[model samples]
Target chain A: MKPMLAALVLLASLGVPLLAVAADPLASPGWPIAQNRFLTGKTYVFDDRVQVIVPRDAEDSTAVPGFVRVQGIPDVQQIMVFAELNPIPMIVQFWPHRLEPNIGFRFKVQQATPVRAAALGADGIWYIGGAWVNAAGGGCSAPSIASADADWAERLGEVHSRIWNRGDEGRRLRLTVMHPMDTGLAAGIPKFYLEELVLVDDADKHLGRVEVHASVAENPTLTFDLRTGGSVRIQGADNNGNRMLGEVE
Target chain B: MMPRLNALLGFYALLYGSFAAALDYQLQPREIAAGVYIFEGRQEHFTRHNGGNIVNTGFVITDAGVVVIDTGPSRLYGEQMRKAIATVTDQPPVQVFITHHHPDHFLGNQAFADVPICALPLTQKIIARDADALLDNMYRAAGAWMEGTEAVAPNCRAEAGKLTVGERRLSVLAVAGHSGDEASDLMVYDHRSGTLFAGDIVFHGRAATTPHANIQVWLQVLRDLERQQPQILVPGHGPTATDSRAIRETAAYLEWLDTTLREAAAAGLDMAEALELEIPERFKSLAVIDEEFERSVFHLFPAIDQEVLHGGAGNGTR
Candidate 1:
């Protein structure tokens, strides 16, 4: 008990928050718990350079668009995004090997909550960024429209993609694939969604991969910035092992 | 005693002004052309303050009877509109034409139940399927104003081409894209007055609602209407116009919305970012521009983004 009190005094002297692993910039109540669950004793700091963009008012709660840019932190090994208050809080994880650490995605928000991104740097520290996304609620529990379609099975794994020129910035790749991305919160619906999307160059060299989750909107559309241009292949599979492949220049 | 009576009169006046005036729709019809009168609602979105009277309803008094074009938003509004029309003419409403299935245009079917309430076949079907949900939304939006209002489906089909009722030579034209479906919008051109009732297809001053709009199709319909060159144009919302300015304004707003969404998509701006994009200064004068623009972005940006991503030929939205 003496040692614990001493440690608390030391933390207080250092101005470290007793609750959170690090001070949350967004002041989310669930940030401390999220840090414990995701980081789990890993060192991290709240960084403004890791920008997370979201609308102040989300009209369509089911398809709230989000973008994260981790260009401020170099040598990022992996990045994970989540909504703090969602039933299924985890959204996606990206292992951007050779691609830029910038990604855009549509996510489901059960309520107005903090949406965040944590980038794991090579130095073994997690850098976090987040923003408050206001919504009308009930997005996660509502079953996706694709789940209601009788012929959704036939349309599964279909992909549409395009690559646009960004001049000096980088090439932008936007793509959407047919999947329900069911969160399973709705009654009678089971959890099902794409688990991985692997981006490959024309030479069959792997560039990066995005691990999707049930918190993503149905028929998820994703946008990414790549350092290089040329035709690229997008190969993906759902949790049930259904696979799809598409190409874009 | 005289002072007390005056005080009592003042108290009653204040009470009437506060409660009764607020509750009443107080519809007044303005004669835009010979035999054609239009009740222009306030250019505002539905609110408890305004009820759902943000739409224009008109009637043409002819030798046979009155031809009512598009009933107002709710049953109360419909009842009030009928009373207002009676002040000008003793003839009852013989035929009711619903321009489309939008709640503000057709939800007043109860007032005109005795008459043949007509709409496009598709419009009638859509109203049958969606009116209840639309009415529920109105209740949520306008609160007590929508009390006791029930959605009544159109009982008669309004066909395109010449429609003669009494002495009024009406050309019923079928249009679409405003309601976001094929052959859903119906426009009436009165040959006698040269007045055109352009339903929700045209809006003056107020920003257009695009929940079910196809921008390209809407533009084409507008162009066709411009060619008609009616003497007076009564839009579904805002003031009645003598020229084609309403038609042009609606076209311009739709075009700007279309272009803005397309460019934002091509630029890789997400929907959230697109919502933050600035509205042009010229369109700033339009009523509810900011809210309507936000709604339009939410309703449309996904398809436009998909289109840009697919290089224009992809099937947009399931």
Candidate 2:
């Protein structure tokens, strides 16, 4: 979603129409959005250079495949994924240190939502790509069908992060976390999910920026475009203030 | 004579085509144990090509009458199974045991209309609750295969206890079938032959479906069954095993999934990332890992996420 349209969707989804108050969260937001310093006052454009690929129809609601590609850019700074229909629509803000403008990943889609991937470049301008995906819509509410084993309790919160070269100039950073990403919509299911995610270098320098929406799907997956081969680390917290950290090579 | 031969061949071809078209898949029974015959189903989900023939059925020949364990995916399958069983035994299936409430296991109940169809009380209740929807889904997935199919609830409750079938005494253990604490699965053990009819509990090479299952209890039950030393194992979807190896195999896979999901959750990866995970070398050999495992992650990740969010004491929200 472009900056204006992302804000435009906020107006449509939350029914709050305001131009002056759209700059910051405290001023006024269409909804409750996680505060971000980088997103302030940015005019986003519908750029053909950016392409967001998502199946028009989701085969599986939870782990629906998606990708973002930024053409004509050698070094892209950040990519942000958004599910316009989700209660929390900021799927993830990704920073790629190796530095390509392309990434592929998957997340949940609740109903038919405009899945938007916004690419930020060195020009400080934001380019947006989007697709309308018609999902059966249980990504958030459906029960996780992984295992019924009692031992799975001890294995929770584990992360398996990997970086596979795209064979082009960029690489794919894939990580799997054990989380339900529950939306509390299902009967008796509470809203338990990851609330924050951060990408950093060895020195803890923020590589890219990201924010996740409740529609991120359970056991969320984050994929990023890596332009260079460098050491990177990921750290995040869930709603209960539980924190996790991982590194990808 | 040549014209007559050609005419005879044409008549036979029409007969063969109609018969083959109606009974698309043969219900070939393989005797897994003494008086125990089984029909191994294909390792695939319900699709038009498969005709919903993705369930295993077993028939036990007793001195008094025959006892059938699980009807196949459709009424036609059950009819074919009955005909196949009759070829080996004179007695008809006096009683039919519905392993669980899965459409593939119980939709064939119409063919067993004459006999008492038994299921766990919870299974019957679930069947009753989701009958119309499940049937509708089956029809949508496999149109012609589900033509004669109807959702039939078990009239008799299959309680966990010892029961006599002719001269043989069978131990019917009610096992926790789903994470919901419903006896969604049943283990029928024949002490006489040491054969364990593990319905949907022990998937050897076949991938177990997790739509309505509790993996924790299932793993524990498989461990217990392994220790009991069943001579022959008859799973709901895979080839029968002579040893308790099937139990161990199924338990190991669930354990692997437990570890994978736990690690992924801890790292805060989303379901999509987890779904893209590479199957371990050991699990790569397992059938349906490609199709079944991803679906399972979608189904199982939610509950696990809730478990961790609540600090392992799950909120019982699921």
lDDT of 2 by residue, B1-318 (tens): 999999999999997787567656678878877887888888777877777887787888899899889987777777877888888889878888888888888888898899999988888898999998778768877777777688889999888999999988888888874323557787788878888888888887876777766777777788788888688888887788888777787888888887788777655444445666778888787777777886677567656755654346664323
Q: Candidate 1 lDDT, tens digit per residue, A34-127?
A: 8778877677888887888887767688898888888668888989999988888989999999888988899999888999999999988788
> Every model's DockQ, to 2 decimals?
0.41, 0.07
lDDT of all predictions:
0.86, 0.72
True interface contacts reproduced, per candidate: 0.62, 0.06
Instruction: Please give the lDDT score at residue B293 for candidate 1.
Output: 92
The TM-scores that each candidate's chain B achieves against the reference are 0.92, 0.89
Poorest stretch of ten by lDDT in candidate 2 chain B: B309-318
Supply every candidate's count of residue pairs whose N, Cα or C atoms clash at under 3 angstroms: 0, 47
For candidate 2, give the docking quality class from DockQ: incorrect
- Cα error of candidate 2 at position B70, Å: 0.7
Tell me the deviation in Å of residue B316 in model 1. Answer: 4.9
Clashes of 2: 47
